[model samples]
Target: MTDQRANWTDEKDATWMTEMIYQVVVLGKRANSGFKKESWQAASSKLNIEHRVNYTKVQLKTRNAEMKKQYAQVSQMNSVLESQRSDACG
Candidate 1:
């Protein structure tokens, strides 16, 4: 088994990147605000242990930004669908 710190990627590892986004973005839902640096540091540690990959703060931040935009679009679509459903049921 390779050491995670030694086997890091060139910031293009999709699997690692996706998990980073899920960790940081999902954690915000469980808290009152943005994730602290310590929170992400812990997340990186846990992810390294579980996935044998390393994700830096900058990578996680980029993923969070990209996911937030996608989340907003999905949220809007869900809202429209709910409204259509409400109309159909009436």
Candidate 2:
């Protein structure tokens, strides 16, 4: 159990796992035609059958807003940490 815990807590291993998951999701989204399709014909065909385009658009916009907020928070965190490090070193 201690060995397993040590292995799981490895930073390099966690970073690799995070990168793998990100790559998988990025590739999967790229492979999805509905998200990438731009033609009215293709979009209409898919949305006409499913009536999900508007909802999906709304969801995407909401997600974009949330991501922006998260990015701002992370940037602020980095700024604070950098300032703290500078003050400590100085």
**Whole-model lDDT values for every prediction:** 0.61, 0.43
Error of 2 at 35 (Å): 15
Q: Give candidate 1 regions above 4 Å deviation.
A: 1-33
Clashing pairs in 2: none
- Candidate 2 residue lDDT tens string, 1-90: 111222222443334334434444655423353333232223233432443223243333344366569889999999999999999999
Deviation of model 1 at 75, angstroms: 1.5
True lDDT of residue 63, candidate 2: 41
RMSD of each: 7.8, 14.6
lDDT of 2: 0.43
Would you estimate the TM-scores of all the predictions? 0.54, 0.41
